[model samples]
Target: MATGRPYQLVVFGASGFTGQFVVEEVARVAAEDELRGSLQWAVAGRSREKLQAVLEKAAKKLGKSELKSEVNIILCDVSDPSSLADMAKQTALVLNCVGPYRFFGEPVVKACVENGTSCIDISGEPQFLEGMYLNYNDKAAEKGAYIIGSCGFDSIPADMGVLYTRSNLKGTLTAVESFLNIKSGSEGSCIHDGTWKSAVYGLADQDNLRKLRRQIGHKPLPVIGRKLKGRGAVFYSNELNQYSVPFMGSDVSVVKRTQRYLHTHLNESPIQYAAYTTVGGIGSVIKLMFAGLLFLMLVKFDFGRKLLIKYPEFFSGGHFTKEGPTEKQMEESSFEMTFFGEGYSTGQDPQQGKPNVKICTQVKGPEAGYVATPIAMVQAAVTLLKDKSSLPKQGGVYSPGAAFSETKLIDRLNKHGIEFSVISKPEA
Candidate 1:
């Protein structure tokens, strides 16, 4: 056991549903030989009772006798800056599970950035994330704080996957296409009320709607673009044949901003990219129809607004438990991304033929959220801890792919059991 001064890893909102899983993951890893001696962690939430319950469950899962005497519990409310500051002061790193972040995240982030503590969250709200980036990126950089958003299954795989593929291609990448196909065996309700909260926020703000439209238009190809011309809707690629829909949140802007940052700060590649949910046949048609209806409702009546408020559970309750999918079921759930790049070759002169590269990677199923998220986040936290010297010295807000290289991230994720591979083709 590698025991020493434990690195304090605090989980905020530990009493919440997702927060509990995060706490359990930290406990599980801490019990392992590689992580045992060096782990000193605490769980925080507004309710001390709920936080204690979470800690108890985690301790029990680790076989109480074999683990440490007890994990610490901290009560920190997002609404209280003083409490948040105190919590930040204690932890070297913080994993924020509080969401509908447009409302609750800024203060927590402010506390961490000012305290020089690194922070990560599962927020998938674009406007909130972009707002954070605009407001905090500079201050964070000045204070040496690494504030990373969307540290979950929503965008990490795709964002980091693009970085991985680009690493293999020596020259600038002109474009990239990414897709996510998820099938989880363990199903209770994974949807979070956060989605409804965000939708309501967007609906209330006319400026937000305009900003989103402008952002979408800025892309060479929209996040959800029409299926490439005429391969026919019948099995055009291993991914999907029909037009894909915008993943509808931060995945769009995060991926785009990531590629933009890579081009600006690191590679100067100026890559064009888009991300979407791949659907085909009746599934694709149904999705399109639903989207159309939703759009019309938003445009004409207040149908969308009423539905969001009245049916919060319809979008917010599906969460996967550890017992969700069996090993075999996990093997069946997978994700894939195809990179379409047009740029000059790396080795030969600029005159060499423009090589168009198409690369793809697939992982087994149901593992998307359960197995992948915890690993990605933990690895991201570790990277923030271990590679502090090389990272953006002054931190505000950043995406993993933009701020960190794929080599370190992919290596860490792979070691933790996430598989990554690639495929390529010559342009016609």
Candidate 2:
């Protein structure tokens, strides 16, 4: 499908904390035998000095002489559309690591969509992404650009995991429940200016709930309409035996989209799904109490808002170090997810099957953000660049499993140190 010379893959926000990691990933992939000539990539950010410093460090760390020589830098500001448009020019793909995307990402995505440059971001913010879906999906579809978000650790693995399990199911899948278990080496901190920006935007906006509703209105069904149906004001499931919180973002959107894409594009089985953070025992009680207090405080008192601002560190990005789980530790770290599904088939007598799949993947590392994110981001980009024909033509936004095949993505991920496998399955 690509008729031009080698595509230019640009990493925007290349000097930021995660941006540097992405650059290293780009270099690592470039050193690989298969993907060597498929991309002409560079890192772009506002500060040339910071960008150069990162490039120098990356060259040293990667032990690649040609890295410094071959990589180029482009100066683009998220606030400036003309600058973004210029940055988008001649580039077939843009990997955006500049976040919290609600504030700074729109211009970059707008530029990419208008220019027909495929774009991906490591945004975990659901409201912002939902806004994009509502506002730009049509334009992006028209332009033939794939403007995907949450390409990072927040949702990709879990989203893809569910997709893989669903593909293995026999009959129509009525529902899916996913659980994520993360064991990390450190209590993560978010210190970057981008994190601060996202915090400020989230704090300043009182209408996020309303915005979320509007955004959901534009998203595909099973995603937009599915609510956790139960009797109590809050219900607990004994399977996980935890109080669930609304997974506040694109995780639900991405998962639902994956299911929708499979049904529409691949003719796979249709299913309903929900994602939630698992909190158990005393932790659940604490969270529930905290939630109640916060709800009452926000609804009843300006003093509560003031109290929250006073503890901005709790809310802002500076609380966590860029230090991530080491490779050896990540190797020891493990991840698990369980899917609950029910199937019914029309027969002489109706049959009911309660089939559940549980999968656990372990790799060498700490928190997923540091190592896993870079691998996933770069591999997704590589998958996009190398396997263009397999992707959908109208690429406004897509999940990993929906956008690319599980085998292709899993192979690419395995090359970058993350080993994944399904642990259990529903009986045929």
Candidate 3:
């Protein structure tokens, strides 16, 4: 269906905060491929003026003045089905950046599936993602459209990070526990209110998500070894010498979805997984506890959720803002996720006692929300474009690990700045 498409990719929502960075990342890749000149992409949204401004800003920042005139603009809105269908028809794939996806994502997914154009989004909302799969997977598969979510910092680093760890291990990798450490260079870090809004709504709809899971009716994968133990809400991590808490993102859900897909379709052994993020100190932990308690209390009602959305900075301790972080702050921030895996050595029996082998791997990159996200998303798009044959035989909704596990996605990410490597040799 993608043969001789006018454009290979289209950046939908190109005028949004994160969308602009995606445009810049695509421009960077375009500049690097100046000699080949095969990367054809455009910016898309409801406002041509905003899209043009995005291009101009990216051009000025990248020192590529041609970008303003070179990249095309397509006017489309999630509310208008015809416009979305038109936009989907013009491209082989769409990189969706418009988020709080629970509200705006499905229309684009429907359009892409109807048009047989694959789509990917950096959504961290599990309800939206799982809902899309439950509703559209069969239709998308029939139409040859791949709809994958959480391609950004939310889960890619964790999902694909697990894949990297398993592949590097010398034996059957049974369990993986990932610890995320985010560092701010003197400038400090902040996230946009869009992420905050998404979280607010995702939490408020937890009951619906639970109901949707029952509708999906997927059977559980068999346990291969000792089940990974869950940690307390707050705990101390000797691994990084920092106070830690279970990561409140979509990583665990996304990774489990990928593991389920692999185990069911490919008959692969499933790896137990747990995810955590480091909190700075005892003071930070106390603050986090207070904020978390308040957040949970507020997310249960309409008025409370509204308040949470209206004053994101106040609630998040200035970690999230409507204006977002400055370029300097983004440049100064970075993240690393370390994966520690335990499994049995080769030729070991499945029912054996005390699995002996252990290995460690890490994925590190620039500022998680804005910087590394665009890089991972654009690289995933490029990989989908260049390695179609390596993807699933038929397109459908999938997680990042399920969709790009067989492709050179990790290698492409490495060349583009997100590094994945083994940090320690296997030990018995």
> What TM-score does prediction 2 earn?
0.80
Best by lDDT: 3
lDDT of 3 by residue, 12-67 (tens): 99999999999999999877753247878899999989999999999999999988
By TM-score, rank the candidates, best first. 3, 1, 2
Considering summed lDDT, which 10 consecutive residues are worst modelled in model 3? 30-39
The residue-by-residue lDDT of candidate 1 on 44-155, one tens digit each, is 8888778877777777876664333467777788999999998888888899888778889999899988887878987777777777777787888887778899887767
lDDT of 2 by residue, 1-428 (tens): 12252446899999888899899988988878986665688888899999999999999988887777788888989988898988887588899998878778888889988888888888777667667777787888888888777787766776766655555545444556665545534532233344434434554564774666664563444421223342243446566676555443456667766777777777765566666554456765575667555644553456655544455444322332334334555455544445554443323111233333333222232346656787888888888877777787666766666777544876666666655564554554
The C-alpha stretches of model 3 lying farther than 4 A from their native spots are none
Best by TM-score: 3
Which has the higher lDDT value, candidate number 1 or candidate number 2?
Answer: 2
lDDT of 3 at 389: 86
Q: What is the model-wide C-alpha lDDT for candidate 3?
A: 0.92
Off by over 4 Å in 2: 1-7, 186-246, 264-269, 280-335, 344-366, 405-407
Model 1 Cα shift for residue 189 (angstroms): 7.6
lDDT of the candidates, in the order given: 0.65, 0.66, 0.92
Error of 3 at 304 (Å): 0.8
